[model samples]
Target: MMPQLRTLTMMRGTRARILRKICRNCPNLTTLQLHGCQKMNYSLLKYIFEKCPKIEKLIIANNLLADRQYAELVSRLEHLQSLEVFENRRGAGPVVLRFLAATCSKLREINLSCDYHPLEDVEYFVKAKRDTLTSATVRWTMAGKRPGCLPLLQKLDLPHATDLPDDAVVTISRGCPPLRHLSLTFATSLTDGALAEIHRLKHLQILDLSGCSGLGGSAVAHVAQLAALCTLLLQYIDDLTELQPSLRHVLDLKQLRCLDILYSGHIRAVAFEEFSVRLVNLRELHVTYEEEDEVFYKNVFAEMQSQMPRLRIINTFRWTENDFLTDYETDDDDDTDIGY
Candidate 1:
């Protein structure tokens, strides 16, 4: 009777014994996710592959194991749809991912962000015949950058490849087309010229250039041309003069929702004043504020309530070391008052 039951064994602490029994007996079980458990090993995986003939989604995230063990696991899990093999080290991710891509046939989405590598040789997982791969996120330190081709990709999030030159950026930009969400944090090699290539992607909805310190006004302006954009996260972008050129095109983005401008001390009061009026569609705004203009954020928040009713999350407060210490002291005060 247990062999007929499907979709069991997920997110419970005491169900270890029950799951083991089910896996030993159940032939109908398909989806299995055993994350953050120390007791489980390759034997458990071997049992599932040996017993369960049908498997669609197999997630074994954050499970520390040797490279050989991981390779063996991937080879055995032949019918996986969604595979997440995130590792603690940088090189392990690519090693495991390459092995899985070679082993799995019907994968749809994969997340390999823990791998600390530069945009190294991208693992071409999608089959040439045709596939249902729609979403993927790969984060790596600057090891190396190369042109990658994923035919059936819709959503992609990559690390800031500061080492990648214009040619490398161009290679990636050419490969992925019509992307919905794009993030390029700490991509130091990117310049205004790379922005031109990005403008070709008309389907982009979210753009995050948080640590792109080199992006000038021309690039920002080019990015603002994408009318479909809803969220923009820009942190540590020191180039202030170029913002006006970028902001000029932002007024056209009617669907723009959230903006996070943390640590951009270069932004003047005039920029926010103009930005507040132009960003009628913005729901959340985070920016730097001088000690003198502390009241300005409050005023802007009040005015925005009428037009930006969706503004549920607002961070108009300035971030300072003193503020951090004060908050820490307040927390300590509460802890002391409670006699902890």
Candidate 2:
């Protein structure tokens, strides 16, 4: 018996017969990832769920499952803690969410794809799991408004939430005080006021404001106030012309490790130099430059890497010979390079 087999990942085209055998043998399986496994049916899933009663983390992405099937599957996993269901159109609706909230008392992390549902339903689930939930990723339209608190919640990712407003942000900040990782990617309606409200999350560590077109320099200024921040993503934020002077405020974040400023063309080279020099704990820096500034930014990255040996500079452009010639360099490394 493969009792020690705690994790299993099945890619696309996985056969149900093989899964059945594996699950039967691995009774202690704690984590299972079935990505793009189109062949999965309710009967097979139910069999696996019964066999692997110890599953604590389950990721089912890009598959097809109905709402009733989803509810049935989740009802069996009494030990479930982290659940992620992405790109599976029909399964993750109000019925499944409410069912999970009621049955999965130990559920802590939930990441679901963008689905149209009443804001009240989402709020109900959040309220139900408030004490146990630590991380949540649910993208719903802003059709309703309510005030609720989740004191134990740490991470909240609301990517592509186009209609997210300032008042909603205020409510979230005031409610979830201990939030550490907050992602508001493409939350276009948010402005400086929202950032001001988010500043109150004293323990915040990772902040992603990528694709947030409405934010300006003041937003950055508010972000700079979060002393505990380690990773900051400001990609696609076009308004940074007035940020040059207040850029000094960012240097105050002594614990910052990763900073992404991709497509933020307004920040000057001198400012980048200052950041590379002053931010002692910085380990990764992501940036993009215009056609004319390509060579200049390349040189700046090289210089930054030279000064901070531990720092990894990333950009959309291909790495040149003049860039850091590290031992891990390989031919397969393309523009979207992953640094060690």
Candidate 3:
């Protein structure tokens, strides 16, 4: 009689009979991670819930669950403390979202993707229990789509927050003192002056200021001061043929694992060489193929490969003149349609 299992991870193609037997055998599982399980349905879920009443975390990523079954699952696991909903095909709609927000009194973190009505759902969840939440990720549901309105989140992740010439940046910085992760990709009106506000968020571990046009290659110095920064995404940030010392401040981050400064913004051959040498723990570096200027990217990539053999590169450079235009917005959001 083996029991007291606190965490269980079942791989894909895990048969229902075996899954049920496992659940029955170890009834104390608090964290169940069974992504890519095509056979997942109400019966298996019901058995799991019945056997594992103490479950506090559930991850059903990349799995297909019927629309109606979500509520049943939630109802069975009102005691859940963490949940992952959007990594699958059929997403849980507002009804289910609202139900979870209301019922899951112990919920401290949730990973959700929103294409439409992005702001409303997030606001509801946060407002429902302000003190309970410690982490939240409003991942962009579709790559083609951009994030819309967002609440005054400790971790603000708006695809586009209206960064007017002045008040917007101040408001953004002031709103999120508790911010740990901020992704303001393609943000409008962000200027060099705004760095003062952003730099104050020292708690930030992940910062994505990629595709920002208004910044115009001016804020990396302040960013380097963030002691907790780990992953920095700066794709197509500005026009630069070589890496300046100001920009090279990124090398200061001791914990940085992933750096995506593609589009060859001021990063020259020597700078790239220095970058490869400095980052001991670097795992991924994304850069564009400077076909026109073979001296820049081609040489840099060759040197990087030689220096760091274990690093991964996402070479889908596909850069165009339009890349200089960082304004990532479309009028499609005016309709306020919710993705169901």
Candidate 4:
């Protein structure tokens, strides 16, 4: 029942061999997201470039696409509009950015998470006039250094991430005037002061301030004032306990639909229940670390499913029949204890 298709993409878990077969057939397809494809090799990627000549978007998140492999792929597929090299540890963020900037002039979005040193080269590309460039995400976890790719972005995401500082946030607000989605998770250095600066993005839709254990209730209060925010992720914020109390200052964000409070450690079951009652329009909500409170998760899930009947998938597990967990499950499951 799918619509007349021009694209097919896969995420979570997709075998490389099957993907290669698909690539050979779908030459006219324009987008491909091969995330968590562990068996992905260089030959398959090259085959994609050779067969799928119309591909304009490619995403390889949390997958293994080495620097040389990426360079080779980029060199072959010159018609890409969006290129993502997520969670790569070989090169610096700037180095990868510069490489993409050099190869793909039509790139509209790039999400790079790398651990390389020195970001000056990447910064240069950000300043370049690429009219199509709109969405970007850059993360670097090295110590005693600041990455500069954030300042020149229009849309930014660093959800629950550690290591970036307050000055970097300020620089981003000052430089990237069109920023609409900002995530400042695990940024222990941030304070209430940082939120005030980035409030100028009138088009802002998504905001994440999870894992920022340093900020107090005031920071959450400040973010609630963002008029255009629709999605908010507030996981691991040790300071803010009760949602109604901490986020009481701005309780009238009627446009809000999604909220994530995973591993916050401070959220009480009662507070969560009360908060959900107020969110009449919420379509998606996630709160983890409540396994002991199975009743809470079940109730929340029930409420979510009832309110947002359009939900298609919900996955939370240590191991399942899914191929990604096949190896782990095979190694750990106690088969001898099973009477069946």
Candidate lDDT values, in order: 0.62, 0.77, 0.65, 0.61
- Model 1 clash pairs are 90-116, 117-141, 118-141, 118-142, 118-143, 162-188
Error of 3 at 95 (Å): 4.3
**Candidate 1 overall Cα lDDT vs. reference?**
0.62
Ranking by TM-score: 2, 1, 4, 3
TM-score of each candidate? 0.73, 0.85, 0.64, 0.68
A best-first ranking of the candidates according to their lDDT comes to 2, 3, 1, 4
Residues 199-260, model 1: lDDT tens digits: 66667788887887777667767777777888888877665555556655655666778777
lDDT of 4 by residue, 1-340 (tens): 2223457767566677677777777777787776553455677778878888777887774334445565657656767877776664443333445555666767778666554424564454555633456776655444434434444356776644565666677666666666678777678777767776666665678888777776765666667666787888777655355443546543456667777766565345324444445655666666554345667567766765665565422324222234243433554655643321
TM-score, candidate 3, is 0.64
**Clashing residue pairs found in predicted model 4:** 92-116
Top TM-score prediction, candidate number: 2
Counting only residues 3 or more apart in sequence or on different chains, how many pairs clash (N, Cα, C under 3 Å) in candidate 2? 0
Query: Which parts of model 2 are misplaced by more than 4 Å?
Result: 1-3, 61-65, 89-95, 116-119, 242-244, 318-340
Expressed as tens digits, the lDDT of each residue in 81-199 for candidate 2 is 99887665554444356666788878899886546344666777777888888999987466565445888889999889898888888888788889999999999888878877777
Kindly give the number of clashing pairs for every candidate.
6, 0, 3, 1
Q: Which stretches of candidate 4 lie above 4 Å from their native place?
A: 1-21, 33-47, 60-73, 86-97, 116-118, 129-131, 140-154, 159-161, 242-246, 268-279, 288-340
RMSD of each: 5.3, 7.2, 10.0, 7.2
| Consecutive 10-residue window with the lowest summed lDDT within model 4 | 312-321
Q: lDDT per residue, candidate 3, 101-154, as tens digits?
A: 776778877766533234565556666756666556554332232222223345
Error of 3 at 148 (Å): 16
